[model samples]
Target chain A: MMRLVLGLVVGVMMIGQVAQAQNQPLRLEITEGVIEPLPFAVPNFVPANAAAAELSSDLARVVAADLIGTGLFREIPSSAYISQITDFGAPVQFADWKAINAQALVTGSISVSGNRVTVGFRVWDVFSDKEMKPGLQFSGTKEGWRRMAHKVADAVYSRITGEGGYFDSRVVFVSESGPKNQRRKRLAIMDYDGANVQYLTDSSAIVLAPRFSPTGDRVLYTSYESGFPRIYVLDVGKVQRRVLESQEGTMSFAPRFSPDGQKVVYSLSQGGNTDLYLMTISNGQSKRLTSTPSIETAPSFSPDGSQIVFESDRSGSPQIYVMATSGGEAKRISFGNGRYGTPVWSPRGDMIAFTKQNKGRFHIGVMRANGSEERLLTASFLDEGPTWSPNGRVIMFMRETQGASGRSSLYSVDISGRNLRPVQTPDGGSDPAWSPLQK
Target chain B: MNLVSKLIAGCALMALAACNNPTDGTDGGPIDPNAGTTSPGLIGDQTSPSYFQQAIGDRVLFTVDQSTINSEAQSILQAQANWLLANTDYNATIEGHADEQGTREYNLALGARRANAAREFLISKGIAGNRLKTVSYGKERPIEICSEESCYAKNRRAVTVLLGGLAG
Candidate 1:
């Protein structure tokens, strides 16, 4: 048995040598950059039935757009392909893809029945001449065809990059219109790529800081309809809402959902003093988390729901702090020269993204959960409210230009401080809170 | 500042003469029905809303990111306090605002501080606490349109809007 194992190890080494002599599999280490993007091709998905003829092709297009938008993968246009994939189950002609320098290939098929749709996809490492992963399929309502496409793209991304995917997600934000003084803000939600925008609230009253629930079925936001800041919870699908009860004279704002969606942590001000409070959603009871005289707000929960991160000015300036979920002695985490606020815990539980203000400039930055290895992504005149993508690989925040004509817009930057791009909205937007990956 | 003050005084004097000349009827025209309706006592009343707004200055300015009242803002609030004291039938809502330079939450808290600072001063000057209410608009309401210091100076202000007062 030992001799057989020895011979197998030697054979594996020889195969590795032969693989290196040929083209090795496409391995992307995110830390290394300036490298060429992986080249891949996705033929228009095949339609399994007459009802799926157009949707199959559209779903493939959306999947391709999702992968290509990452800037890590480049799609070889159909014009450049020498062969077409007519059969989803047929053997892949790796030789043809190899000739075109296509390192990876994705082939998918779609089927529709009634209000249901299904997408099946497979990824192949053409260079290694082998399938990278087992075939996968997703079935959902036809109304959510885009989500099915996102799932397929996410599968391909995770299989290739060895990281979680953020494609199948949503963002809740405050959409602004009109002039600066008379600006009307409403709660708006959209897909991760800023498509399918739906206004959850009207522009009747000013709204700020729309945050998504853990399940993405509801949202928490602060509205001024009551002539003062009050937190309200709205069901995303039903569009029904109710104000969260609090003390009569106190104001509540800057709310975020706990990871379990069972409670909410927010800031409440009374008698000109602000503090953090945690409330159980099942019951209307709330417990004060911080009792300092200084302002305390912008509370976010760690993914495990064991601790809370918030911003406080009790130490003389607004800085990030961490405390037990049940409220106890807090420890300051930000020792930087400038003030810090809006610290959002990454879903991965490794880092926290925040907005830092320093010598006449603002930046969207991230630091380790313990407040180490701090890195700034983008700097501008006014960049605030940093929220992590569902996968924690990207951050979305709001930036406003300087001067009178200044308008707010949403911007995202990769965690590596690259691929900074503006998310186009119908009008000005701010306070983006990215939702978790959709079910 | 001096030029604006002089301009305001000149305008007030012209308004006074305009009020008197309307009653003088030196043009010898038929007695205008509207002339009898023009009551200088009500129009120029020190406790009137227009006088409080145009003459006493309904708003006070604050420095960048700080809520501590300067002497100039204190003088304005002091005059406001005197007005509120003389007109016991009036209640005011102090709306604190910040320029579009800071984070929304921080600016909200800062605006609250500015409003509280003004409110505390008014209370110190014998204005009843129950008569004053405070709210922070926090960079949402900007009176000026520019982004420079001149505009920001106007944007970071606390305006004392009279409410629930006696009828004119």
Candidate 2:
């Protein structure tokens, strides 16, 4: 009897140890340095009506592209799926997704009526065998089908990752056509995926460096229509533009709207010297923020509008510098080995995205606001003009091909410096200015 | 000191003689006496004399981040004016360009200012303002495409393109 009791006790203890070992949180052991992209599957969305079949496919594709563009998620190709989703509300077959090694699944449906488009989507965790959150739905014009899809993607991304979504944003860029020597460029805005493009200005005269306001309603750019370089603000809704401040003989460019949209910060060249200046939009009054003889341009406001980051050649080579909005002795923040230009502060306020030129090659890179941990994300013959996605998880910039046959195109990469892909456009593109997410 | 002063005086006397010599006949002549030598003269002789008997040096270079002309540019302008004077019937379009090192819009503005500086210099040198047109190519038309100082030096120049030279 004693031997039986002893044996039973030992067996019970052994079974308990095995159960604890099996349930040890699965030993996720996610390494902090590896920066692996999250894996998710985006299946084709079902159309509520036969007329929406095409739109449903397009919507799903755009959403997947946007999410994958962030480099945070690796899209599991629909070809890998063993099952089809006929309804969004139907329970997902977790076993099927697990078999294909998709940790997350996104399913949705699209309904179109007249000019209206309604989309509904849900994100599920296959491993947990549970819906991550309640279903999300949005409605808009048929023309806004892409945007509705973006919103749905954003919701799923946010719910699963516990971060904001950037898909529902817009991008304003300079559209280029014609020959390289005399390229005709105009300001253009489109959906984040390069759809629904609209030309904001005719190529009557040269326009450069178009920047969107934080609210995404106004654009600030420099135009040669006046036969000189001067700043102009255009209301996106009205398409009417007015000179922000007209100073004769002095050149002003690289204009950025303040976070509050009250002032514009830009570079002004006088007597052959370029410096930065801040101009109050309401009063048309301006103040010279930097008096250095160095070429100071590409001024970007911090997310809180308390500081400004700009590129300057005062350090002998072009580098990024940060200063208080009120203006004072600026501190050098970039210690990289190459020349840096177009230092744009990220919307997230923690990093500054810049274009670095080194060893006859150009790279798009990001670094902390303090100028440490500089990481070169992409390197090529010519890569420049990085614009951050609204959530700051992705960066879209222009990359030009090599040699005489070079063509420029837009590319997006995640903050981790992964998942670089070219954004599709009708023609070549550059100077992407991402808009704020639409409410 | 005395010898130097005497040499300077002798040179001044010779200069005065040259200015006053009516027989020299080089001071003034038929502005278009050779018009018949060229095709309809609307396209004037490849070489023709006119009120503006000078060629404005078609190009000016700017220092980095600067559109201001230096003393070297001023000396070049003196020669440019002579060229413009010889081709008075011609109007010119001054094109300003910049190196690719700068921002596109800023370079455009800088290029304009650089071109304007040349225009102002030509006007100061007795060229009619209406005869000179100004445009900025910014960093678009780089004579040299290499990303080096040697190439950039050639790029940061304002070029004067001659238009409608010396009508009969």
Candidate 3:
């Protein structure tokens, strides 16, 4: 009887161990894979005063929009809410949100005092029935209410997605007008949502591409004002600019600052030949990095400043090539059909965002550093010049229409190839460069 | 050959007329009757006072990765030279333009090459070197509106615009 009982117990123990092994939660691996967006609800935040009600509502709407735009979350309609959020400090009723199929819930309170405003919010995981992040409070001047709301959204996004936030950012681009043959382009900057636009340069002279320095307080771009293409750097805050290094007998364009912001890398054309050159900002000393007869341009530095990915026709066609930042033999990184150019390394340092032309259609694509796993995010008649969100989860690029009445506009898409939409601009725009999230 | 024979005969008569009346008809009338010998040349030649106003259709298309002018561009240059010879007083500015296909900087270089090619061709055709200037618009301007090959073909061109009036 003892032996029989022991055998039965051992058999049951083995079976239980096998079941436990099978039931163990899978280790979450954050990589280049499909991630279903998390569903959440944001009830209208309550205002402390009547005068603060409208701004509170607007703030809540903007926050929701910003979170949903990241492609990592879906905002549940307020109408579907089972209960209202009357107090941000009160405990979240998990059942209320769970009943409505919401995995997360956001609730906030807005208070305005004299010339200052304060916003307090909390995010909760309804399924886990726990606070996902600490209760956050932001206080600023009444005029800075929108920025405070964006910061809160960024905090919530960072907590839930385990990635940096890009909502509290800005973009600098070229606003274009007139006909195709006589385009007048000006340098323009705006909030990430396309609000608070300010033109930095007049359209008197043609401008090509504008890139933001790492600090977001300056912009480097190419202009044709001196009867030749040359690079210029503008102080965004002061509206002052100076030509970087205008060498005679050579035309330069496609300027990008080094990650350290100490140098500018651009292409210079002389004797009917083009090559990559680097110019130090302090001394204006320029060095030729590429000496090939083949065309080399559109150079972007790696996040670590070790390598550079640029477009070169050394392969007999326009393709992306990677080389050491110190300049060496370049290895072709784009082998897929069609041509690829304008490669910008992501801030995360994992993938490169570029414009790919195949089958007469242009696509914004992301590929690993080694040129594997190419995934195209958006396609159009003309989609080029991709700039990455600070988190590297999204790409912003310009899409141009075809034919005589054609126009260019800004659009962004997630790396998962979803949420493609036009970013509103006061005018037609192109060559969008997303600035890092402001401090 | 037949047109050449007729032109030579006309030139002989004009020479004889100039010998008879050297100064009276030299100022206003057509002293050289051979100038009107070819109707197409006459009309085209009159519109341009110097080589600057003369339009020779001197344009070139670059290959996908090339900035060099090929053989077909040479033929266009030969014709441009003939037109420049007929109209001597014009100074020309060769504006180089590229298709919207390559990077902006590379296209600028490519456009410059196209302009240089045309400029060199004119110089080789015996046009004064100082009479020509070159500027490149890169891929900024496109004469064709479409994004297809047909439009690209028209965009890769070097246009010679007259800067000054022909010298009398």
Candidate 4:
């Protein structure tokens, strides 16, 4: 865990703002109202050598894509550029950018030596004619150029919005194929913006609900490989897996890690009833959290790990409930007109995102921790299993179509219920669990 | 009553047909003496597994999210109980499934309830508790694919899959 601190030591050159903005720096609010996207520009990064020429263009292209994809920023085409950055230390000509209505500008330089690559970038406030933040530099292996590009975009985003960025994150999900009756599912993972797809498990068995650990080192999922539903924990880097709960006769599923990644809370079914159970990850010892004759599953921990929010059917139909981390009487949280299930505590611990069904239509929704100000973010034929972004500003979930030809895909929406975008997978995908921003 | 009588008669006829060549009554295709389908191999010379599946009903239907046994499902499960009691050599694995209308986790728990409901019914009918095992596939394995009630009704089912010659 301490490696995170070391990873942040990327030799930041503490060069203070090259200039000062006479007014406030360029900023945008995450609002539901219709907003004209802030226009920004990123010309090709200046290459330090002939070998770095191709990477320089790609770095700039990736950075621009990451920013524009947020819907809060719009990319101003290079064709609209009046000045090209020939040097990394050159000053920006704000007057020319203002003529084209460019509110923000990003400039960077890339140099490659063998396998190591170094990048330096600065964010400029075009409207104020000054740099918004201190200039920063990042160095990494050539294979991680995309990551460096994303880091650049994240810095630019944070500087302007004064919030954490999510571009350097990944998502774990279930990949599906075949028909509705006999679908084959495999555990799969990919980048936050749907790049670098890699399969974690083959389709030999049905795997569902792949959730990333808090530290992003492992994944917990349910698999039916043993002729029964069981929980499995897999090391993402080693690509190895082991059954977390292998008690014969009883079945377990819907496993989610606690915030600190030291324990797991999941539903274990016995006799005819299902109840939630908590397990210590180190010794495989489990303790019952809820004793009821109803379906209780989809447990999620709050950011501080003092409480858990889960779905239970004690009131006849499935609804959201919150209970203490050590387990006791749970307080029902949802008072809506529908059945709520899969209640996930947001990373910020301020809201809980969930899947709800009302009048035959399924929706992805969110509510305050106390279950107030309920807002439905999406409504479709089938939408379930929501996972929050690391910053809690966005939620990515699964949506399925209807009829015999029904198929599911991953989708994401901002907490404001805007920028409803489909996250592309190589195949049909569902049950997306977003990982934290990687170091 | 009508479907019950018809099913009983069909079972008897199918049991007989398993041992003899079908359509080999007078004026039929060539009647090879050894052309009978697989023998029943029942220890007490009772019904075959196919007969139990097709004519005696090896499955029970559930409506929507409810796992309670209906009057119609009760009658079918009663027939299954009678057959299992007579055939003491086989254990059964009850597979429960749900339609794709709910969340995956809830439907899985729902499926387990359905299987256990059927298993409990059989147990009440004198089938040893150890003779029945249950597993749920949630909405993962649907026998029917359409989203309409026509298919959904069938997809939400509890199927009795017999484990050959294991129970005492």
| Best candidate according to DockQ | 4
Q: Which prediction has more favorable lDDT, 1 or 3?
A: 1
Local accuracy of candidate 2 as per-residue lDDT tens digits, A308-355: 999887877778999999999899999868788899999989999999
What local lDDT score does residue A429 receive in model 1, on the 0 to 100 scale? 94
Q: Which candidate is the best by TM-score?
A: 4
lDDT of 3 by residue, A71-170 (tens): 6678889899888887555566777898987877777778788877767777666776666545667677776676767877887787776778888789
Q: What is the lDDT of residue B73 in candidate 1?
A: 88
Per-residue lDDT over B1-168 for candidate 1, one digit per residue giving the tens place of the 0 to 100 score:
343344434544555433222233222222212113222223354544456666778788988877888999888888888777656656777778899877888777777778888888999999989887777878888878677889999989888876533331
lDDT of 2 by residue, B19-99 (tens): 212122323322222112122222112232221223223467888757677888887766666555544545666778887
lDDT pick, better of 3 and 4: 4
* Window of ten residues with lowest summed lDDT in model 1 chain B: B26-35
Worst 10 residues of 3 chain A by lDDT: A1-10
List the per-model TM-score of the A chain.
0.92, 0.88, 0.90, 0.96
Each candidate's DockQ score against the native complex?
0.39, 0.13, 0.35, 0.63
List, residue by residue over A13-95, the lDDT tens digit for candidate 1: 22211123255566766663564778899888888898888797888888888887777888888898888988777777888
Candidates in order have lDDT scores of: 0.80, 0.73, 0.75, 0.84
Ranking by TM-score: 4, 1, 3, 2
Q: Evaluate residue A1 in candidate 1 and report its C-alpha lDDT on the 0 to 100 scale.
A: 4
i-RMSD of model 2 (Å, 1 decimal): 4.2
| Angstrom error at residue A342, model 4 | 0.3
How does candidate 3 fare on TM-score? 0.83
Q: B13-56, model 3: which lDDT tens digit per residue?
A: 45443212223223322222212211122322323222112343
